[model samples]
Target: MTDIPLEHVHVAPEDGSDGEPAPAVFVLHGRGADEEDLLPVAAELPDDRHVVSLRAPDPLQGGYTWYELDLSAGGLESSQPDAADFRRSLDLIVESVEAAVDAYELDADRIGLLGFSQGAITSLSLLLEDPDRYAWVVALHGYLPESHADLDPDGIEGKPVFVGAGAGDRVIPDSRTSAAVERLEAVEAAVTHGSFPGGHGIGPQELEAVVEFVESQAR
Candidate 1:
């Protein structure tokens, strides 16, 4: 097993890389979910890309969470992340990406991030922190964290970002996703927003759009 920074499951490229470093898409699941939760979705992505699904570091409830949520403000809509835990998790993800690149023989220039909910939030934060590090990002049912208020990194100009939101999602609310889209657009990232007709999860159409997005990048 190629040891990276986090617990993960690596899915090899269906089409061999032909001795060249292959592109990779790293998967990050939502809170209360594990690495295996998104394997099915990962399977639908481009076959030429290596898929690495990572388990969150901190165990929570029966699953795992990228970081703890501060619900003291009331419902999930008002909840914010514990800043310290968020930063720590971000650092760990960065380390894991570096290790994954070397161990998996991945093309570092084509790294993509696909995340859900809290995982989506982390992906957006990572892109903002170091836009040049990632080629594209897909965040489903997630919002930009408040901790990034002072962060406005350069080099993110024209970065591709996909923000997906559910119209009836009470857990995250569509407004939050809209705000994230605005923020990404303000930063000059090429933002493609998709709205589903369901609640806090990815629907069939949403998944299709995600696949299409990843396919475009893979080619």
Candidate 2:
């Protein structure tokens, strides 16, 4: 759909809806990965909802990145994001979701977000910026952006969230994911935090947990 803001791959529900508004989960890929990068994960999602996997706006090392990394404060693994690019990408994602709501006949109240690495960072930021806009979130191998520290947590109360991390992840540490979980918990969000043994990528255990979390939320 041209009206939708970002370049994406839209997967229809496995089961036919017969014109009813279907629930939707918007998928965002990690840095240097395109919209197609996370499509395999979509196969595990509940069969009754729409899956929209979005490509980042900026081109990067043959793929795309939501924002440039700021490495002045630390090494590549602990680097921060360029504030301008990060905010722009966030706004664009918001617009994309709003447009998709009407374009895809999605159930606005059941909107969910699934993201990895940098994508996970953005997803969590979106939830914090306007917690009521999303029904649930799944963020894997990512941390909360520093710019979102002043969020109003009231709207996030009881919202279901799945935070996953790799114990051996060098790019985004488990500590970072834990910090995000703590922040969400402080807001009274219903959060499920998990850590798998691996390095910088999703494993079988992580994927299974993700599917289970989404299935529970979908129900």
Residue clash pairs of candidate 1: none
Runs in model 1 deviating more than 4 A are: none
Report lDDT (CA) for all predictions: 0.91, 0.92
| Tens digits of lDDT, candidate 1, 1-219 | 546879999998988989999999899999999999998998988788899999999998899999898988888898888888998999999999999999989999999999999999999999999999999999999999888744779988889899999999999999999999998888788999999999988889999999988787744
- Candidate 1 lDDT at 153 equals 96
Which whole-number lDDT from 0 to 100 does residue 128 have in model 1? 92
- What is the RMSD, in Å, between candidate 2 and the native fold over all Cα? 1.0
TM-score of each: 0.97, 0.97
Q: What would the per-residue lDDT of candidate 2 be over residues 1-219, giving only the tens digit for each residue?
A: 999989999999989788988899999999999999999898889999999999999999999999999888888767778999998999999999999999989999989999999999999999999999999999999998778855766688999999999999988989988988898888888999999999999899999999999988754
